[model samples]
Target: MEILVMGLNHKTAPVEIREKLSVPANEAMGFLKRFEQKRIFDEQVLLSTCNRTEIYGVVQNHAEAVDAAKRILCEYSHLDLASFEDKLYVLKQPDSVRHLFSVASGLDSMVIGETEITGQVKEAYLAAHQNRHTGKVLNNLFQRSLKVAKNLRTHTEIGVGRVSVASVAVDLAEKIFDDLKGVRVMVIGTGEMAAQLLKAMTGHGARALIVSSHHEERARELVREFGGEAVPYELFEKKMGEVDILLTSTFSSHCIVTENQVRSWMRARHDKPLFLVDIAMPRNIEASTEKMDNVYLYNIDDLKEIADKNKALREGQLETCAHLVQAQTQYFMDWLFKEFNSKIAASGS
Candidate 1:
């Protein structure tokens, strides 16, 4: 069997293309099953994030497999296949293995060395496994990939100076708050990064949460599920002073929270330090807020620096991972050879 990866990433495609191809959670399993039924591959795993949409597979026909995956991706994205095909990339066999390993290791991430891809990899693997689309080849590849990733994290100091944007937000918060359980965090927007940061804080025993968004109804739904209150976007600054930690990420082109706005909120709270994490591009918080005494502000660029530092540290340990995948791939190839030889012997006999 030939292994391959076909897709576009943040490096290859812009955010516009990436978002269009991104698979939603509800549609992922169905897509995998459809690929299996079509015999597009012997095994298939789809990895879709904000920055990438990739298919890792073991297929009998590389060209057919690439075409089918591309077709399905285009259908999902509602794009014209001819228009989007030129933007995609396809890698076969050994190179595919190396590419996937690099991806799972976060070496290929837009923000190189982020830990999010490992979880995305695991999710993709699990989706394939659950649908019974994975065989010995994929099973070994994913298991070995995970092990390699673990080693990269443990052995490398890349994760040293900084971690993820979410972790950095929590790190700054932890330093300010003696206890997170009592603090209230108001998430100003329903964007993924803000949700992720809030979830991280929730896992750390943060109990009080208030979700505010332009779509108040959706915010109410999330609030109901997560057991938080829903405040309207108009009241975001009003609620800002009430919450201990304020995290914001929205698609707004203009500033949502200005330097003057945060300062005005500060006056109501007796100068209590507020942990604000801005994970939005173009930034959600004003730059001047960083200069404020009680306002600790972190932007996306700052978190990206942390991810880059960790990536540089992890690059050195990838060789050991390379060996691990090489050994596993050789084993799979050997089994494949043995099976083919047995088939030939039986036919001759």
Candidate 2:
């Protein structure tokens, strides 16, 4: 069997293309199920994040699996396959295994050696397993990749400092404000990142928060946990007018807050500083809005740069982690190749 990965990533494509190709979380299980039904590969896993969407599978025919995945992804994303086929990087066999191991270990992340990719990798593996779409090949691959990631964290100091996007935002907040004890925060969306940031921000003596999300239940849950007030999405502007900090992470495709919206909100505070962190791809806040007085806006890439700086601080340990990934990738390929050979022999070819 041949293992392969075919997809576009943050390094290879802009958010416009990345977002267009992402599988909606609500639809991943069904889409994964449909892929299994086609029997295009021996094992498969699809990883979708703000920065990337990758499909990994082992197949008898590399071309067939690539075509199938491309078609399925294009179908789900509603994009023309021909438009993006040339843009994607397709890795096969040993390179595919190495790529995934690098990804799981965060060597391939936009911010090299960032820790969140491990959880994202684990989530993708769990989702594939829950859908019954993964077998021994992918199971071992992802499981081992995670183990390597854990070992990397242990053996290397790659993740020694502030690691997550939430944590980094909190770090930046500390730089801007002398103390968060009196700062009022407003979280624009109740997604995972926003929720995590809310938790991080709370410890810094944040005065209050207004949680606004499309899903009221989720918003209420986060509000309760973080000791914040829950509000509907419609009340975002109202909350924006009252807060010193705004952090947004949502699944919305369009800009939720624009320059005009912030302009009006700014008038209420006489241009008091408002820290805006837009963690979502296709950014929830408008880029133009940053030009407004006292509005500090940062997107995911900005945080990623901060993350890269954090990663660079631990360069003494990164080399050791790289060696570990290389060693583990080789070991996995040995077992994987042996298994494939045994399968072929059993077929009496």
Best by TM-score: 2
Superposition error at 153 for model 1 (Å): 0.5
lDDT of 2 by residue, 1-349 (tens): 7778888998888888898988777877887776788988777888988888888887877777778878887888788987777779999867888889889988888777777899999999998888778898899999998998888878777777675677888887887787888788888777787777888899888855655555778777877787868766776676776688888788889988788878888888888888899988878889998777667898989887876667677666767777887788889988976877776444435
- Cα misplacement distance, residue 118 of candidate 1 (Å): 1.1
> How much does candidate 2 score in TM-score?
0.62
Q: How many pairs collide in each candidate, listed in order?
A: 1, 0
lDDT of 1 by residue, 1-349 (tens): 5778889888788777778888887888887877877889888888888888888888776677778877777777899987678789898766777677778877677665668899999988997798788887788778777776676667654335445667666666788996677788888778767777877787666754555555767677667656667776766666676788877778878788898888888888889998887877777788889899988887888777865665565665456555655665566556655765564345335
RMSD of each: 7.7, 11.2
Models 1 onward score TM values of 0.60, 0.62
Query: Model-by-model lDDT, in order?
Result: 0.75, 0.81
Model 1 accuracy (lDDT, Cα): 0.75
Q: Over 4 Å off in model 1, which ranges?
A: 163-169, 172-179, 183-349
Model 1 TM-score on a 0 to 1 scale: 0.60
